[model samples]
Target: MSERLKSFIRERATALGFEACRFASASAPWDAGERLAHFVGEGRHGDMGWMETTLERRAHPTAMWPEAKTAVVLGLNYGPEADPLPQMADRSAGYLSVYARGDDYHEVIKGRLKILAGQMAARTGQDVKVFVDTAPLMEKPLAQRAGLGWQGKHTNLLSRRHGNWLFLGSILTTAEIEPDAPEGEHCGSCTACLDACPTAAFPAPFQLDARRCLSYLTIEFAGPWPEEFRVATGSRIYGCDDCLAVCPWNKFASGAREARLHAREALNAPRLADLLALDDPAFRALFAKSPVKRIGRDRFVRNVLYAAGNSGDAGLVEPVGALLGDPDPVVRDAAAWALRRLEAAGLA
Candidate 1:
């Protein structure tokens, strides 16, 4: 009966366009709770208050939702058609991470997870709750335990066929399914992921310092960016992906199935000068579909102006200088800083 249920769930996931699916029981695995507590205690999640709010709930699925018996994990690949690594060298244009270049994964992945859960409810009459990254569930570890993929050296799940470009979602159901054997670690002696981080976010092989992670700093944290990190941020206006991109495992995966994940023409290589001119309405209109919308106009512009300071281009002076009196203090402060950096370098 369990085997039949597992097969059925896998079929449902594939039909829903999910690249892969696996099952993990509600019980926490192999010191998962203690490790998680340690991670949080160290304040590694940075200023993502949501992580702190959801602490107790994240350690175990059953604790978060009383009825959760089976976790049906799903993976979606959102890698781009082109290699994003080369663009990092382009000082004239700002680089937004590949994940943020497309439609927001939160909306896209959540919709599909909900639809998959809806189908299961219709077929089995089981109560189910859908969760994407929004929940505090230890998603990566659960994925590894469920045999979706092993957590690679970079701490993201990896598959021989799909690489590290997967977005994970879960359907926690009251119904049970047979579980697959957990995947074994395949990283071996490779430290490619560790070597690639610009800010050295991965202090050890598998652990990450969220404070140094560009994704955490730019999107999750709101106030002025920490002073020490400004120079290391470079022109990465959004998340950083050097670690993921450098992984040799990605060669097997294809581009995203969703066309919206493709980089927009304007955003693929935006000039620093262009982003500084983006006021609230203008920014919203421009990024409605893209993931960069989460950071809002002020934070996004602040990030862009940080890049403008690094841009070392006199052409950015007038555009970036204009934000000094902007409505958002964050943007104004960042603008003042950029203008000074530009003038100091004699680019102004």
Candidate 2:
């Protein structure tokens, strides 16, 4: 009966657009709490203080909800149609992480998770709770235990079929279900992800220093970027995908077909000049459904200004210069920094 229910869940998930769905015991297979403790203890999470606040709950699924007995980990692919790294060469245009170029994954994956959750509750008469990257839940480990994928050295889930471009969502339930065999590590000796990082975010395999991660700096981080990372950040305005793109396993992954997950042409390689010009209203309007909107106009433009500074295109100087006196001090500071860099390089 458990096997039948598992089959039913996986079928429904696939039909609902999830590329993969597998189950894991709510207890989790690894010492997730200790691992998290080590990460937080070493100060690797950086300014993401929330991780510290939710440490106890994130230690394990049962810690979040004692009644939960099974975890249904699901993966939704958002693979790019072409290589994203090449766009970095055009420093005048911004490179958005593939995952953020479309509708926010939280909204997209949550809707599907809720639909699947409702179906599961009806089938098993069990209480269900859904999570899509918002919770403190350790999703990658759960996904790995469920056999959806193994955690790559980059610290994101990597599937034989979906690679690293997968968004994870989970349905925790009161139902007792048999868990699937765990996926064995397939990363082998490859260090491509670690070497590809522009910020050297990874101190070692399977460990990430979020402080140096461009994605963290551009998005979660507020205030001016550290001087050291400004040039290395290149033209990436929102998030960086270098580590994910360089993975060897992506050869088995396919481009995303979900209409909502596909990149909007305008966002594919947005002009740095145009991005720097976005006022609050324009920013909101332009990125209404995009994950990039979460950072708000000031932070977003700050990232653009940094990119503009790194861009050897002197033509971008006018836009960067205009923001030097903006209301937001963060924007003003970034503008000043960009101006200095551009002027020193004779690009301003």
Candidate 3:
């Protein structure tokens, strides 16, 4: 009966557009919680204080909900048409991470998860709850246990079928569905992801220090960044893709099948000058439904200013300088630093 239920859920998930769907025992004991405690203890999470606050609840699925007996993990591939690393070489243009270049995955995945959860409840007569990336639930570890993929050296899920480009979502339920065998790590000796990091965010294999991660710096950190990170940021305005793009496993990957997950033409490689000119309303309009919009206009422009400073494009000086008197102190401070950088490059 449990095996039949699992098969039914998997088939329904595929019909609803999930590329991979598997089950795992939610109540099983694991060491993922201890590692998370150590990550928070070492202050590796950077400005994301939520990790510390939710530490206990994130220890396990049952920690958050005692009734959860099974986890139905789902994977949606968002692979780009081509490698995104080369786009960074065009320093005059801003590089939004491949994931952020499309519609926000949280909004895209959550709606489908609700639909699936409803169907699962009807079939099994069990209560269900869904989670995307927002909640305290540790979806990646659950996905690994469910055989969706194994967490790689870069600390993100990697799959033989989807490679480095799968977006994870989970449904925790009271149903005792049969669980799939867990996947083992396939990244032997290869350090492509670790070496590719511009900021050296990894302290060791399978460990990440979010403090130095460009994704955390651009999207999470609110204040002016230390000078070193600004210079290291290059033209990446929203998030960095160096670690994910260079993975050798991507050879097996293909472009995203979902049209909404495809990169918008305007966001592929936007001009730094044009991005530096965005006000609150303009930024919201330009980034509507984009994950980049969550950072707000000020932070987004601050990132663009760093990119502008690194660009060495003389045409951007006027736009960068105009932000000197902006209302946000962070934006103003970034403008001052960018102007100095431009002057140092003899471009001002």
Candidate 4:
């Protein structure tokens, strides 16, 4: 009966656009709570105090809900068609992380998860909950346990077929399903992901220091970027994919086919000059459906200024200089930094 139910769920998931689906016993790894306590205790989560706040519930699937007997983990591939490194060579343009180049995955993935959950409940007459990054659920570890993928050295889930470019969504249900064999670590002696990080975000092979990570600094951290990471940010204005892009496993995955995840041409490599000229209204219209919209105009512009400073395009100095009088003090501060960096390079 469990096997038949699993097959039914898999068929429904594939029909719903999920690339892969696997089930795991709805129980946390033995050390999951301890690991969370340590990660939060050391202050590695940075300003994300919510990790500490929800530690009890996030520590285990059963802790969040005792009725959950199975966890359905799903993967959706968003692999880029071409290499992402070449864009960094064009200093005049801003490089957004590939994931943010299209529609927000939270909206895309959550909507799908909700549909799957509804279908599962209807068919089985069981309770279900859906999550897609917005929740405190420990997705990567659970995905690994479900055989969706193993946690790569970079701490993101990496699959033998999808690499690390897959978006993960989870559904917890009271219905029982036979669990799949857990995927074993395949990283071996390779350190490609760890070495690829410009900020050395990984303190160890599988441990990530959120504070030094460019993605966290650009998107999650509020206020101006720390002085130490400003120069390393380069022309990346949204999020960083350095580690994910360099993974050799990506060679096996096909390019992204999900229409909503496809890159918008305008965002691929937007001119830094044009980005600097954007006021609030222009910024919103430009990034209406993209994940970049969540950062808001001030924080988004602050990132643009950081990229402009690292661009080494002396031409950008004037445009960046214009932001000195901008209403947001954060933008003004970033402008000041960009001016000094450009002048130091004798581009002023």
Evaluated with TM-score, which candidate comes out highest?
3
Local accuracy of candidate 2 as per-residue lDDT tens digits, 86-125:
9888988999999988899899889989999999999999
Q: Tell me how many clashing residue pairs each candidate has.
A: 0, 0, 0, 0
Candidate 3 Cα misplacement greater than 4 A, ranges: none
**Candidate 2 residue-wise lDDT at 186:** 98
- TM-score, candidate 4, is 0.98
Per-residue lDDT tens digits of candidate 3, residues 178-221?
88999999999999999999999999999999999999999999
lDDT at residue 35 of model 2 (Cα atoms): 84
Which candidate, 2 or 3, has the higher lDDT?
3
Candidate 1 off by > 4 Å = none
Model 3, residue 159: what's the lDDT?
Answer: 92
Please list the C-alpha lDDT of all candidates, in the order they appear. 0.83, 0.91, 0.94, 0.90
Q: What's the residue-level lDDT of 84 in candidate 1?
A: 83
- Quote the positional error of residue 94 for candidate 1 in Å: 1.6
Superposition error at 207 for model 2 (Å) = 0.6
* Model number with the top lDDT: 3
Model 3 residue 324 distance off true place after TM-score fit, in angstroms: 0.6
Candidates 2 and 4: which is better by TM-score?
2
The TM-scores, one per candidate, come to 0.95, 0.98, 0.99, 0.98
